[model samples]
Target: MTSIALITGASGGIGRGLARQLSAQGLRVAAVGRDVDRLADVEATLRIVADTTTPEGAALALETCVRELGAAPTQLAHCVGTTLIAPLHRTRPDVYRELIRVNLDSAVYMLQAWLAALKGAPGSAVFASSVVARIGVANHEAIAAAKGGVEALVRSAAATYAAQGVRINAVAPGMTETPMTAGLLNLPAVREGAGRQYPLGGVQTADQVADVLNWLLGDGASRLTGQIIAVDGGFTTVRPLVK
Candidate 1:
C-alpha cells in the first residue's frame, strides 16, 4: 500500500526535500506550512496552509489532511523549526518564548494531534533535532535548550505509544545550508569555516538530511524507535585530526 505522509514545514528546506523525495517514490504527500504560496511548489499530492505551532492549528492540519486525502497519514515528518545563534544571557525573554514555540511547542502540539489522528493504528513520526542539542556549542544555548526538549519529547512519546504501534524518532543534524541559515553561511569566509568544523569536512544539504528522515518513516526502520539519529557528519561524535 502507498503510505500517506503529512509533512509539516513543507515549505522549508529539509521538509521540502522530503516531500519531493517521498512523492517521487510514489507515496501520497500532504505538504503543510503556514504560507500558502510557499508550500505551493513543494511537489506533493496536496499543499495545506496551516500553522502547526498551536493546538488548534495542528489539529486542523491533521484533520484537513485526513479529510482531504481520504486516510490517516501513517507517516509524519515534523520539520517546523527555527534557529538562533546567541548566548543565554543575551537571549531575550520574547526570543526564548518564540524559540520554544517554534521548536518545542510545535513538536508537542503536532505529535499529539498526529497520534490522536491515528486512532490506535500503527504510525511513524520523525522530528527535527540538532547536534547542538547533544553536544556543547557556544552561543547556542537557546537552540540547544529548545531542541533538547524536542529530543526528550520524541523519546518519551515513543515509550508511551510503543505498545500502541507508534514509532517516534528524531534526526539531529549539524550545520546545514538552507534559506533559514543563509545569514550565517552566505559569506565565503564564514561558509568555509563552518564547513571545516565538521569532521566529515563539509556542511549538510537538505536532501542529505531528508534521506534519513525518509528511512525513519519507512518499514526498514521497523525496530528503530525512541532513538535520536545523528546526521551531523560526526560533529557530535568525532574530533578532527590535528595537522
Candidate 2:
C-alpha cells in the first residue's frame, strides 16, 4: 500500500511548505484547509477544503483523504493555529475562546480524527506549538494558554497511543516569519527586537520549521514520541541577555 500524508491548514506558510516537501518525497499529500483557491496552489495530490477545527470537519477531511488516496494517511501535520498578544485581564472572552478554538481545539479534534482513521496502524502526528507556551511571555496570555493546552494534549495523547504504535510530537518555535506574525515583523524595530531575543539572532522561516516537522512525521523519528521540540533559536532554553 502507498503511504499518504495529510496536512491541515495547508494554505498557511508552514503548512504549504510542508505539503510541498512531502509531495516532493512522492507521498500522496492531502492538503486540508478552508480556502479552496489557496489550497490549489499547494503541491499536494489532494486539496481538501474543511475546517478541521470542528469534529465533523476533521472527520470529513480524513475520510475524504482515505477515500481519495486509497489508504489512510500514515503521516499527519497540523499547522492550524492563531496568535494573540494580549494580557489576560485585558483580553476579551471571545478572543480567548477563538484562540483556543483555532490553536488548541483544532489539534485535539484533528488528532482524534487521525487516530480513528488509522485503526491500530502505526502513524505519526506533529503539531505547531509556540515558545510562549513554554516560557512566560507577557501580553501573550491568551495565546500561551491555548498552546499550553496543545502541549499538554500532545504529551497525554502520545502516552495514550504510544503502545499502539502511534507517535505524537510538537515543535514550539520562537517568532517565525509567517503571515500570522507579519504585522509584528513588518516594522524594522520590532523585527530586530524580536530577533535579538533569540540566541541565534534571527526569525525562523516557515520552510525552516517545516523541515523539523517533516522529520517528526517520518520514519527517522520512529523512536520519538510525546516530545515538544523547540525550534526557537535557543529562545526557550538559552539566555541571550547580552544585546
For every candidate, C-alpha RMSD to the true structure in Å: 0.8, 1.0
| lDDT score of residue 28 within candidate 2 | 89
lDDT, candidate 2, residue 198? 89
Q: Write the per-residue lDDT of candidate 2 for residues 102-126, one digit (tens) a residue.
A: 9988999999999999999999999
Best by lDDT: 1
What's the CA error at residue 84 for candidate 2, in Å? 0.2
lDDT of 1 at 57: 94
How far does residue 48 in candidate 1 sit from its true spot (Å)? Answer: 0.8
User: Residues 1-243, candidate 1, lDDT per residue (tens digit)?
Assistant: 678999999999999999999999999999999999898789999888888999999999999998988888999999999989988999999999999999999999999999999999999999999999999999999999999999999999999999999999999999887889888888989889988888988889999999999999999999999999999888899998867
What TM-score goes with each of the models?
0.98, 0.98
- Clashes in each model (backbone N, CA, C under 3 Å)? 0, 0
